[model samples]
Target: MSIVISNPPYNMKWQHPFFAQSQSRFDLGLPPENNANFAFVLSALDHSEKATFILPNAVLYTSNKDEFIVKKNLVDKNYLEAVISLPGNMFESTSIPTCILVFNKRKSHSYTQVIDLKGKETKEIRDQRGQYGKTNTNRVYKKELNVLSNDVIKEVLSVIESRKNEVGFTKSVSINDIKEQEYDLNPGKYIDTESVDNIHRPYEDIIKDLNRIIESKNGVKITINEKMAKDLEIYDLMQDFKQSKELNKNMNEMLKAVNPNLKIKKEDIAALSRNKEMKFEVKNFERVPEMIALFISMWKQFVMTLNNEENRLLVELRDALLPDLISGDIDVSQNEYDAKEDK
Candidate 1:
């Protein structure tokens, strides 16, 4: 045989019978069983004087032990001549994409040619006569080439003869650069598909979008003390009312203790009055005001986030009733409610 052409048995890398045999020759272990396609490739590379093998696209750029050894063996000796990457759906019965790899032991040319034969249909007429076979399906069948298009094959042959570098679509990469990419033989990685252009977005528009996203983000804590202002005012008012009531109660008590017959008039009393146990007097008025003010200040300090037990209880009650209040679910008209409702 001028050229030995063979399609070996399909076996995965890990489980294949040839893998054990091949590893000993190449001194590299088999690729993972998930992909044994490379094992066949290695076997072909080792055995054939010159070879053309169809392998699944994975064998081109694998970095595993089998792949590393295969690449080192091929490129170190400059065995690989041409690698043609084909398109998907080339194999209709199966979905695996294939590539045509041409290898040679002797150096025919300085540069390697890569041809892309993807995305093209190949057709062959079964019969020249407009007659059907014995099976009664009366149409002449068209058989397509399993591998390369005529145009692609022609280009490949031409490139092999030319031995010159072609850029953009086809690349004749040097052995040194292939070594730099860690022996990765992927054609798409080498080919630059992007077109150059100056594209810029407006700064104002970008800022506006960023601000919108920031505002849309939920659960961000804001340091705004809205309730603090209103609460402080209410606390001051309550403090004044409490102090006035205590003063009025004390004055009434003191009057009664000083003169038993002297009746304290309701009109003379302050607007707020409370019957407290402590004796009320004008002498204690200043002290009462200071104590009430201090209590109000302490209450202000306590008005922060309700993280304590009492504060937690208050918050729970508020939250529990809030939904019902907002949804108008509870009937406030029911007057049977008493102190027991607190329980």
Candidate 2:
């Protein structure tokens, strides 16, 4: 069977329906003149039994009336076989996201495979290449560009053929499900992470914590019993506990150094834990990334503060300068003003 693989120019604009009028490939009708994304798909399908093309996420469920019709027909006809979402910044010039859209004339399954590789910490292939290629005279700085490794290619192919659901990664979605979602083929729309209900700390750790709390409570009770066994008065028992155990010599001295009458309230508790659990929270979308997103969110706050302070400084400078420039106390020439502004 003939197969066509291409990555046509994204969202290219062409002459209106006039350019598409006589084109037999566009039996589904002309795509919007503003975007030739679907037009490229139609052209490939006409000449081949199957077509696999790279397209932007916008094509998945664009509200554009012309494109929606073509998108719907593709699902209805079962031309869509799989949609593999790749990480953003997959392209050099544009960080606009891209994904692999596979169309098949002979699909063995009733469902389309959906693979999501847009992970925050997922393993990626990258190559060091110059952003600007060799200029015979000046040097170019090479930056790491994400690329497709052979292993990743094979893994994707296997998953598409297998249709075995991998949690937070790949899912096999029915055509009916696609229709219900209005033919939206973005993997994220159909994929979900494991439920929070299923998440639990280790059973051994839980048991250990339970025992520790009980032991602490029991230790406090034993200490009270020892005091009572000595037949000491309740007030004396409390005083000794404070003087010997609760407050150290340094604490007593500090209290005396302040006002002798001043006191810090003390309590006898069955259990107390001074440890704090460290928490890390980021806006994670199912299997999507977190650290980079966390950094971006933190940096945004700094940017906002810097801009606000800059505006305040400018206003203050303007307010300070008006009287100085007008009173002739500080002679300011036009060149001096321009030079100061430049600096």
Candidate 3:
């Protein structure tokens, strides 16, 4: 045959590719054991002067050991005439991205033409996942699908015929240029795209935003969260502190009444309670030191726990801001740092 054209079953496995390694059809190399895509290409080319096949885009640049060797050999032999990349969702059964491979035994050009047709489609219907196709009226794929409009088809034919370079669409790449790309044939790999740079804001502004995240929410009044219930542990601790202090006061008065020169050491209390309804009496003045010792130890630990929580918040704030500041992403220059310190 002089010309052969086909769209074979994509990515299908074949046992013959593994066993028929000696066949001339695989003169380049055997296709990967997992898929018969390249096997179909080679077989079609064996019987004809020119063969064109629709295959999944993976054949263009897949790095599987066996398949890559075959691809490299194909490029080296200059069997490839042109590769045209088609958009994904072209098939009803699978949305696998596909491409057209045109191979010729008798060639006119040494360079291979690569065309990308991703953004050419003007009308496209998206599939609705997780919906029953028959039952759901809203399921788009059941009624319509993406297709190549006549204009897009004409555009592709023109690009192929012209074999001309169009920015972001097509290019005629030489074997040496393809080698520089390390045997990659994906059309997008050859397209040049615009780079977007990040805009860095003032460090203080970013810090304020980060602080809001760290805080989780705006602060509220203490009375809103405070419990009205009397049996709470905090209430008991407050009462114990108060009663002990009052008892100590009464005991001191009693001891001083016996002798004006007598005095005792006082334990300092940072947090105190005043309950006017409670009456004071000395049940056992001797036990007052032990009572103060126990309550003061508990109170000190409670204060320490609150302090530790504050320290943790400080650590977290530093962690959140430090990396961005150091990397110059937030731009906390020496001047900015000094200004923040003044603030």
Candidate 4:
């Protein structure tokens, strides 16, 4: 059996004469406008009975029209065997996350094994001298790194060999399911990482945790509200300053109309308002309205960032807890029975 394995350079533009003249291999679709990830895969498939390619994460779920067409074709033809989402920083040259695509031409099932090994790596701190150490110091520069464990490898192989679903780690997905998901091969979309924890705590405890989360979210809301109130007060001050400026302009026009010889200059008004040392301050104060507006814009953006962070936390909590709650893994029956007994 001929097997081809490669880690093709990602996002390379294919403009070579060979690529330009290649027509038969691009039956699925032409290499995308800017990416040749699938083009390399197709070339390998042409020469070998089975091919394994390490590709960037985008290749699995890129929405580019031509890329998606090729992906859909591969799924439809049952050419795709497995897609494994590896952890980040797996390569020294790039920090972009990667995945492995396994293809086979032999007779097999229509389903593909999708594995999510994102967090399977064990994190260790290594010193500048390449020795594993615990404490970080100036001379002993420390770096947190991930390494694939033997058990993770064995588990991945077992799932691929058995074609069984391993909850959050691996799953066998039918071609129809792939099509339903718009040909998205991202393993995280199908696997729920929280489910793998298998935490079977009491529902009361879960509810308490949720209440704390809600309280934290509410605190964020209160901070946002306070910022908004301050913003409104600033806006009102700006409006008042604008009205005062308008009145000063009208008064100047009236003075000019009343006495054609008399000049009602802004500098004259500043000279009358304060001392020589405060002249610069008075001049710069004219720009206070503009400064206020700019400050308000920046403050609003800061508030928006805070709000987005709060929303992100809420989304993460929901993703982590909802599955366990719905699956009945966090038992609620005990709490319900206790309540009834107390009543």
Candidate 5:
């Protein structure tokens, strides 16, 4: 039997005309409009007796009805041999998480083996080399190249050859079990990863905690209001500092010191004064009072910007939190009840 291996585009969208003409190709079901991930798989299965295709992680457990049905048929027919969920950032071009779907046309076991290799051993490679062969870009390189590690290869081979369940890594699930899971071929669903904490909490209890968080948000609003008031007072003081007699005298002296041939007018200073926000456009002005006024204006602007951002964030927080509170979606008492039950 010939073996065919290909890494098709992750989520290529098929044109309507192609799907219209090639009806025989996708006998399982039509691939979803937004994604062509499964279409590539079907194309490979049609041409080859044994094929291994690299696909996006979404193809494993997509909730789409058409895709789900196709996946269900594949598992029910016992054509799907194994699914390996590889670690994220495995390719240099894209960080879309990927999986290997192994298919066999010949008679196979009733169970489909799934191996979750996510967060396994990772080797960092230089994605882009800089001048003098140094690593250039700020992007952290944690992706696996086309090559798989010897250890990972060995583990995969061991699981396939032995067909035994390995704790937290590999599992051979019956077709009935896969059907029970709504045909979710995601290996993580069946295999238990050692590092993952699968804590399933009730939604009601979580909503109650959100309610408590909403109540605490009131205190945050009060603190933000107080800070805003203080910021306004500081702004007023800085404005007064700009209009001081010392600053006006320094401005006049600096104007006199400049070339007399250069046109100087009171209206120029007046125009600059009209702007509430001060700018350091005054050239050749080294007077102590003028410099102090410039510094004060710049400092006031910075403080105002900081205060505005703080106020904006507070408003956004209130906007975000208040809706869930007012809607009564979060029940704080439920959390209290759950806590008591635990006791």
Candidate 6:
């Protein structure tokens, strides 16, 4: 068994320069500033049997064509075995998320193992020693760690042994599938990381929710009706007062037209009203209270009809602003309307 730990000199040239030439043939441009060594590492991985490597994450993923060519060559030759991603705070001195790559030429198992040890039980540093002391001084305790626990490791091993394709978190894909992602080795891209809620709620629960909604709507209607009733009473009183004033003006105009020289005072009106009441001539049914009641009833009916039409118009305007409930044409998730007001 051979293990190659490779981190080539940044400016070193390979023995066979065919891999460097491959970049040009593949139309991938030269690797950029201070980091052209990844091309040689790719060349080494192409020739070696098994290798362990350290690399910047950018080498694995970049929009540049040269990087793509190098990645494509390594993956196409089946040099990649497994990738282990570590937690962000592992490198205390620097601020970079690091990972370890294990590559192999031939494997006895169908899938490789990846154990993350970054957030495991950390040791306390006493003096310059690399060993832990009896009295703990570091921040991390054994209980407050998030390593690959025993149960987690067992589960991963079980899946690897069973060779079953699991969904979410962990899975295996063919080489062609990896190529489809353009040789990016990020687990998030391949893994189905979406949350899936599969539990079915009962019909009774839905009915209860709908009932609550209906009761809330009815409460709103009651409040609106109460306010409208008070407004209606005030509006009717004002309208009656306006109509009475107009009627008195019309009567005065009629009296002046009939007898232009007759100046009628309030006392004279009262005496005339009393004399008319005392005279009490026999009147036909057509000209009595029936005519007056009929005219008043006709006015009330006209007002009611007008109020109903006005309310209908207001309802139509409200409906135009609201979105349709069916088909989900608009997203009303928070019930916020996308309305703009003119200043």
Task: Please write out the lDDT profile of model 6 over residues 1-343, one tens digit for every residue.
Answer: 5567864332323333456456532333344332354554554555567777754344445555655666666566665666554443232222223455667768655444333333342433322222133344544322111234576657655654554444444556556767787776755456554554422223233223223222211211111132333443433523443443343333333334333432211100000121212222212221223222323222223233223322332333223323332335433453432123100
At residue 319, what lDDT does model 2 achieve? 41
Rank list by lDDT: 4, 3, 2, 5, 1, 6
Candidate 2 lDDT tens digits, 114-229: 99885432334444333222243443443334566677788889988898788888899999999888887878778877875324433233323333322222222212343342
What TM-score would each prediction reach against the true structure? 0.44, 0.53, 0.52, 0.54, 0.51, 0.39
TM-score (C-alpha) between model 6 and the true structure: 0.39
Candidate 5 C-alpha lDDT tens digits along 1-343: 6788989755555554454536765777777755577778777777888889987666776776878877877887788888997764466543335689989878456777899785464565655422221334444333234446888889897887677897878998888888888787778678854553333323233333333222221111111132343444443433432343233233223323222222111111111222244333333221222223324323333233323322333343334434444666533433221222112
Window of ten residues with lowest summed lDDT in model 6: 263-272
lDDT of 1 by residue, 233-339 (tens): 44343344335334434333433332334321221111222332221122222123322332333222222211121222223334444455466654444323232
Q: All candidates' lDDT scores?
A: 0.46, 0.56, 0.57, 0.57, 0.54, 0.40
Better of 2 and 5 by TM-score: 2
Best by TM-score: 4
Instruction: Please give the lDDT score at residue 212 for candidate 6.
Output: 28
Worst 10 residues of 5 by lDDT: 215-224
Report how far residue 198 has shifted in candidate 6, in Å.
Answer: 13
Residue-pair clashes per prediction, in order, are: 3, 1, 0, 0, 1, 0
Model 2 Cα RMSD, 1 decimal: 29.0
Candidate 4 root-mean-square deviation in Å = 21.3
The positional error of residue 152 in candidate 6, measured at the CA in angstroms, is 7.2
Per residue, candidate 4 scores C-alpha lDDT tens digits across 1-343 of 8899999766666663465545667776776545678889888877788899998777887767988888888888899989998875465333345789999877368889999886588876666432222344335455555678898888887888899987678888888888888888888677655634644444333333333322222221111233344444433333333343344343333323323342212211111112222111212222233223324333332223223333333344445445655776544433321122112
- Candidate achieving higher lDDT, 1 or 6: 1
Kindly report which residue stretches of model 5 are placed more than 4 angstroms away from their true locations once superposed: 17-22, 127-147, 192-343
- Pick by TM-score: 1 or 4, better one: 4
